[model samples]
Target: MNTQTYMQKLELLAERSISSYSYIHSLLEELKPLLPFAGACCTNIDPYRLLSTGAVVAHNMESIHHQLLTYAYGQEGVHSYDNMTPSHTSVMTLHCATEGQPEQSSRYQDILQPAGFGDELRAALLYKGSCWGYLTLFRKQDQSLFSEQECQWMVEIAPIIAKHLRQFSLAIPFVNEVKLRSPEILMLSQQLELLSSNSDTHHWLDVLRQHEGITTSALPRSILTVASMALTDDTIFDQRLHTDCCSSSLPCSPIQVCVPVREHDYIDITAYALYSHTSSIQLMIAIQSASPLDILPWMMEDYHLSEREKQIVDQVIEGLSTRKIADILHLSPCAVEEHLQSIFAKTKTTSRRELIARLLSQTDCIISR
Candidate 1:
């Protein structure tokens, strides 16, 4: 085929293969005319399990097929292939993962003598830092040996196959092992969202504190942070109106406050803050029901903000001037101002007052245990 035609055919084949279960078998059948192969099979390699997915055996060899052949080769001990005897039984497919390369193994002696086969090749499929599975192709006695070109083709296409297989596996829903939000947390999140939409800073804070108390009573490890943006522009700076407060004796995790509304070319600014404090200025608040150290990972995952932003946000909320924030964070005041500009842009608040009010208002609803 011409290069363009070949490329088009490859794309069409890939789309078909991805769409149906029988496509792989059909693929092998098509390739048989091009390469010297009797049959082929695909298997998925879990940590302790090998599952055969698609298989095509040569006529009348169904009883001793390639699927069973490969499985027997992998199993603990059958002693049928003497030359390829079990040198390693539990070779976890780590080589494929580390190098992003496929490993090929073949034994002429074993194939010719005990196995009564001509030649075989095993190609490992690696994708996304894991070994997805392997593909095995066989040839009969009269057939020609697999060429270097064929091996290279198999290696090149292994990643594509692995990706497709991974996607297909993920598409299969696991009804038996699904997680859902608890009724209480769902209700509490919704109630907090509602309260945050309407309340003032002071009232929101009180409600948030009560909610924090309840949450601590239930999930002793949970922390709450509330902020108010009641006077802040929700479009520019989506801030919280109230956040839960906790005592130093019963410290909560440091809540990283994030405002997503962009302003002045910034997306959002985030900072870690204490939930309970003695200040009345209340620009932004961070609450913790868990230890500060324990909260960092959660903050990273939950807010998806960087450490630098978190530091800046924390300093800003603590009533620190831009210079102070820069000094503490070891950044130039100009740099701090740049980050703040981005923060203001993202939060949609032009000034600190508006930012704080918005944050405080949003965190108004909280459920204490």
Candidate 2:
């Protein structure tokens, strides 16, 4: 099929309300005809920190993820996903970036070459300035290098991919309703290896690995990103800190992040560096369900709600009646009802039950602008 036809298929697929994993999996299958690759890795990026929240790997790309993350956080490599500007055409190839001498890239020399991979095409899936994820396509040494024309085509559809990823971030899965369990614990070595984990870790790990395209043996990119953050020197990581959590005045202990596994259920991951008298020891990670406090911030930003509206939405999620919400906020019942009306309008729901269901359940087929 031609590029236009393939893109049409992608557009149609993007319109469907599906899980992020399903969307990404189908997207890769469709891209095969337009831009073939030996292997690929689609990673969900935390827009705030530009960190990998999860990843979907096809073919043998999973083999190199550990090394890739090491290089990604270790050095400023050529065409780093974080460095790429968020645009419809935010894409680059190692050969093009290195002016045909791909050897100039440390990632190419250290990671790609050894993996038997050649040219790499990477696109940062950014929607309206927020990077939702990334797509990295790899060709084998024997295969032809990705042409500039192909890179341009990827640029054209990059925004569409970003839009779907962002939309799917809020999509509710069709899976059985499994409320997030209590906090689980895990221990990791400085090298980012899983040293030990409690029994509860399996439940969370299974959910993460099942949805995140990770094998049982491999660490999910979310865990890897947080664990890496804990081990990284503050001096080096300070340059990359995008949030205010690392301000000099405040004591930042364990680095914590709320990873959205589905629409409303978020896995709160906190990584702590265990240090001894002389040096740092193993890294400890606590995993659990994110409270409404944590989930509301993302929902408010995505829905573009005001602070008061967010407060109401929080109470609505708790099944609070308008009168109860008003009592808590010291507002009259009429005022609370008015605020609820606005909240429903902004969230595209009609009644309180519908609004609550919208917040708790999967998203509709509404595509983001």
Clash pairs, candidate 2, are 172-362
After the best TM-score superposition of candidate 1, give how far the Cα of residue 313 lies from its true spot, in angstroms.
26
- Candidate 2: tens digits of C-alpha lDDT, residues 184-254: 88888878778888666876787777758666767777888878776664643453344343333222367
| Candidate lDDT (C-alpha), each | 0.39, 0.74
For residue 238, give model 1's deviation from the true position in Å.
64
Candidate 1 per-residue lDDT, tens place, 193-243, comes to 222222332332333334222222221111121211111223212122343
Candidates' TM-scores? Answer: 0.35, 0.74
TM-score for candidate 2 = 0.74
Per-model RMSD to reference? 21.4, 7.4
* Root mean square deviation (Cα) for candidate 2: 7.4
